[model samples]
Target chain A: MIAHKESGERIDPTGIKIGMWLFLYSEIILFGGLFVLYAAYFHRYSESFAAGGEELDRLIGAANTVVLLISSFTVAASITALRLHQRRRCICLLLFSLLCGVIFLVNKYFEWGAKFARDLYPGSETLVGGEPGLNIFFGLYYIITGLHGIHVLIGMVLLTVSLVWVVSGRATAERYSMLDNSGLYWHLVDLIWIFVFPLFYLVL
Target chain B: MSNQSLEQQQQEHLLGYRQLAVVLCLLLLLTVVTVAVSYVDLGFFNVPVALAIACGKVSLVLLFFMHLKYEGAIINISFLSTVLFLVIMIGFTFWDVAFR
Candidate 1:
């Protein structure tokens, strides 16, 4: 939101932010509906879910969690740097955050590759041959993580656009709603992963 | 007006680098704690404990990272209402499953 004193133009920051957050609310509900599905299935197939979670590599999951957390940190910090007119620092932090997102996707690629190698995909014969609940567990796994991966990709694209905007002077300190909103989207991604990690990888 | 001083005047919630770093440390610490806690088998309590920590992390991210802490009442209420509805939906479904 910018207040152009000379032209008497004003943008309400709260209105701008709340508009973005309204969209984020919908995103949360979309994922929340999925979580409810996971809950019901988990309620019925507790053992199968536990077993499926055990098959996952917690180390990789933890590492991704850290990557996302750090990425979020950088994104949030970049906004601060922008506000403070530390343009170089802001750009550097955004580059680092983008790298973190790339690392996350790379890690996910290897993780899913391992799963496919084990024939544990959605309609794999192994799950079809094994306990029915195991199929449900793995099915939910693919759906949730796959959807989240797409969100990560979209977030990276948004981040890239925001980076360019910053570089080109479109998102200055006074007028940075684009960067701020993009950061909000990125944080929502991290927020979802916070729940996903424990639910899918740390099932006890 | 200079952008920097004007921004400082208008945006009270412009988080500093130090504050952002501290929030990151807290989030990382929470992540480690949740993972470490998952190692101990706390039958029946494990999910709850893990979820509790996840909630903590979410709170920090929402408040510090997402700027929800300094936002307006409309946003705060809207978020709370959304979460309430989500809880109701999930709760009702589980309640049905439990009785079945």
Candidate 2:
């Protein structure tokens, strides 16, 4: 390690953070594009969007929100554990966070499965072939939530990798950027869900 | 790499367990409040009110969970600029739609 440092190979946490922030910016922009579309369609079909929102299971949405919130907290606590050099605690917290992600995805699977059962897919007979407004509402719903589910999966993978590193003793307090970065990404996931939850589930 | 610099950095970045717990509680409380509020009919104010609550939740996550509050000016500027650009994109789109 000393040799690597002597050779100018060092971990710069600041640089890592800046890069992460830039990546997060691009992510926000990606989702922002979808928000623009949602705004346009909501303007065009206010009643349809409300109708579509009413069909969503608010209880499930609320449960998912709680799950993600707890996960975000655990991930943050994991980073705090890392800083304190409690590797075991950090790994445990990360595992808990990963479990929350799984629970979230499971809930999503059931939610989407139920929607599919009702023939409420994008081009399905019930939604797309029905009213134009319902078509757009459900279409946007699938695209946005599907994309967010993918992010949740990605965040789980990241936390899992960080957990493995912690177990292997690679992610020490001195070089914990991996863990910190994962926490940031997880927070981004939660942040997006905050908006998505309201736009789809609550703000009818 | 020195012990002193390592210690200094830790001092700067280390967050306490109690603080994190408090923030978590606050977030959970806000979640319940938002959901409860949604059950009412606030007319046009419903969307805006829900969104405002969501924004509050996001701010807490960004500041405490993501540690943006503890970070320096450069990172703050970088992240805020992204929000600015997002606002621009949404604002312009709304402008065009409203006009047309």
Candidate 3:
């Protein structure tokens, strides 16, 4: 293991953070574009969209929201713990956060499974033969949630790397941007879910 | 990298367990409130109310969990601009649709 001092290189925290934020900006716009589509489609088919929303399981949606929110909190706390030089606590919190991500994905799997069983997916007979607005609704549902699920998987990978680095002493109290930035990415995932849950499940 | 920088690092705010827990509780509470409000059938206000609550929840996540409160100006402006762009895109689409 190359010691941080032996490397003779310094991490610019501010620069690293700005880069991450810039990347997050793009993610926002990416999701934002989809939301714009949702807005336009909703304006055209408000009644059908609302009716479609009524059939979704609100209980599962709310449960996933709670899970992500809790994960975000744990990620934030883990960073704080690292800064405080509490390594064990940091690892525990990060593991918990990863577990939260797993739970969220499992819930999503079942949720999508339920929809598939109902023949509600895009281009399926039910959606294809349904009202046009319901078509758009389910279409948006699959695309948005599927894309978000990919992000959750990406986040879990980032978290795992962060944990490994932290354990290896690559992420120390004096320098922990790896873990810090990982936490930020995790929060962005959670942040997107915060809006997504309400838009798709609560409001539609 | 310097001693002064290390000094500043030590001084940086690290929220305690209690405080982070409080933020979690607040987020969860907002979730419950939003879910409850959805059942009321508030006519045209339902969507708006739900979106408003969502914005509230996102703000909390940004300010605390994302540490926007402690971030520098560049990041703050970057995030703000992204939000501005999004609002304009969605708003303009709605405006165009409204007149149709």
Off by over 4 Å in 2: A1-8, B1-11
Candidate 1 vs 3: which has more lDDT: 1
Q: Specify the poorest-scoring 10-residue window by lDDT in model 1 chain A.
A: A1-10
Quote the RMSD, in angstroms, for model 3. 2.8
Score chain A of model 2 by TM-score against the reference chain A: 0.95
Using Cα atoms, each model's DockQ against the true complex is 0.65, 0.64, 0.63
Q: Tell me each candidate's TM-score.
A: 0.95, 0.94, 0.94
Retained native contacts per candidate, as fractions? 0.82, 0.81, 0.85
- Return the clash pairs for model 1, or none: none
Instruction: Report lDDT (Cα) of residue A72, candidate 1.
Output: 99
Tens digits of per-residue lDDT for model 2 on A4-91? 3555876667778789888999999999999999998898898999999998999999999999999999999988888788888998
lDDT of 3 at A162: 96
Provide the TM-score of the second chain in candidate 2. 0.86
Task: Give the Cα error of residue A31 in candidate 3, in Å.
Answer: 0.2
